[model samples]
Target: MWEKTMPINEVRELRGKTNIFLGVGAIEKIFDIAKEIKEKGIDKVAIVTGKSSYVKCGAWHYIEKALKENHIEFVLYNKVTPNPLSTQVDGATKMARELGAKAVIGIGGGSPIDTAKSVAIMTLYPEYTTADLYEYNFIPTKSLPVIAINTTHGTGTEADRFAVVSVLEDGKEYKPAIAYDFSYPMYSIDDPKLMVSLPKSQTAYTSIDAINHVVEACTTAVTTPYAVMLAKETVRLMAKYLPNALENGEDLEARYYLTYASTIAGICFDNGMLHLTHALEHPLSAIKPDLAHGLGLAMLLPAVVRNIYSARPEVLADVLSPIVPELKGTKEEAEKAANGVREWLEKVGVKETLTDLGFKEEHIEKLVELVFTTPSLDLLLGCSPIPPTKELVEKVYRESL
Candidate 1:
């Protein structure tokens, strides 16, 4: 097998796509930002967030204090849930519109931020419902400016133009929807101070989710030279710091590295696109909305890695070489890489199977059906290095169970 290395030209040519403000006290700076927006004729902004984490972490109070101190007018829609529902996005959009919000501010993890992305655009296109936001149904043409505050170290929703929302299509079936094109946050505040209060479980799960993002991106055939190099570093950082964060949630340095890793991996996967793991994980979380997105991905990634390694060991070796230096650039490195991932997942408390996450055997058929029928399937199969057949996807799901 050929050894892979980053080219100097690719490193020189790579550019930062998103504007990020990171460090302690970054949320306090939002006051000036709000004033800047108001000066631009955007009188009021809609703050979209989840119910608990921000409030529990003090980020919510910090944001409200900033807006109030700056005399910035805003409305709050804090009902966003995990695996945000289309109905929730619709309702939030309507609320933003009725409140005359000129922009959207998203706080919390990926779901609310993603909902804010949808709500910001939906506020602009009142004619387009969540249905039209579906990949096959709509092409987003316009969006309001969005500012993202990431309280969790996962999803990198703040760093990309893409957002994922779940919709109940055909009245009963749960499916994931994605929208892109200038829907990214105008700027992001990635303050590790905000993540200091994050629970150990969230730190573990979200960090693993970041790891999945890089692994999928680096292994895919369409991965760009710049993204591959970035993902390698992201994976290395995750391997080094995830356990540290989990062991001590207040380890600010570890938290910063994990948060930074999420941003790097998010950008990498945003460009390279994700494959079977994300493809299968979506239906599980979409069906069971209460399930955590990272947990679902965690349950599936090891199994997916094993499948990918079987078919394309070289790809696996390329991605895992940074984490498990024992890869040594050989086909045999695939099993070593896969084993390293499984062992790490266990160490990080991601040892759950689908059953452990409340999924049952009966759900497998429905999930397979959704995979084949949903719009996500096209993107999934297209990016997959191996030709993904129904039997293959189902087999992986069963094995994961």
Candidate 2:
């Protein structure tokens, strides 16, 4: 086997002292983390969160009450969206600064945590607009400490430096809002019960999002031995546990495995990152902000896999074969795994097509233009093994229609 060279080493490995708040019922952990922040003499703290599964599952109130009981002067910014905007983040940073919050707590799912990261960065540099932060490496030298609690098992945005804010630059919106800060959470709370109250539809969407993270990261770039190992583990756990976690929502063990798999996928992609599926999905989510990201992901992913099918088919096919059994071992078998993904997504009750979600062909041109013209498009789309052009992007959009 020829040695695989690292495509990019620009991803910084962020290390920070983290006070991990956790448990199946870790209300105590919340209290402990809050008290620690207070005793450390942190001046002010702000909590940025929103109504989501985490709110329904009840971590939001628990954390909120804990902070209030501790008498920590803080502000609350909860007007965040599923696909959060740069404007909202700027608003949050202003809230934090006006309140004089020194530390920030992120509750709910990826959106709020993602919101918190942007707010954390913006607090230190109040002079800059959110647009100034969208450039690849324009972040300030330091930021306020942020703690996150992941109440969902997907899109592990809480544990890393990458926060992709979809903001319009010159009349176009793209993702990857900030990458330089390595906005590593000052703490992470992974509570399995947090996964329990999720409705089945949401459970499926979030789980597949995690699964795709593993598949895309494993196949996106040249895999290092370590990255591949975590990717494989993520795949194994997801394959074995996703359906069970969905079917048996009350099982803490299944919840734990799925949550760990989601985080493993996060760590996997944190090292390897994502490709066209995510890049394309960003616009779909932005255009239809009502769509859960995982739902948009499910809608666009199979098309992305099929689009990339013929390019580097052997390696991607093999990496994916086990998840869809028919693709394992044989060349034809390996090559067919991409289609199997689409089939499995439908079989598992993920939305089968764009029409299922009420989107029509009329939406294609706008989505395609967004995909091409969005800020940071050149960077994210460039990650595909077979480079995609504006035309190819339209083809994927039309096919999904």
Candidate with the greatest TM-score versus the true structure: 1
Residue-level lDDT tens digits of model 1 in 79-188: 98888878888889988999888889999989889989989888987877876776456677788899898899889888887788878756655556574768878778
**Candidate 2: regions farther than 4 A off:** 1-23, 52-55, 68-70, 135-138, 168-172, 310-318, 329-335
Clashes per model (N, Cα, C within 3 A): 0, 4
Native-referenced Cα lDDT, model 1: 0.78
- lDDT, candidate 2, residue 171? 63
For each candidate, the alpha-carbon lDDT, in order, equals 0.78, 0.72
TM-score for each model: 0.92, 0.87
TM-score: model 2 vs. ground truth: 0.87
Candidate 2, residues 1-401, lDDT tens digits: the string is 11124111122122333334334564447787788888898748877877555568778677777778888887878788777888888888888999888888887778888888878878888778877787544647787888888878887776567677777557655665455544888878777777788778878888888877766776665545555677777767776777787778887767776776787677777777677777778887776667788888888777777777666465555556556664534434423665788777876677567788777988888888877776676666777766678888887777776
Candidate 1 regions with alpha-carbon error over 4 angstroms: 1-15, 310-312, 322-325
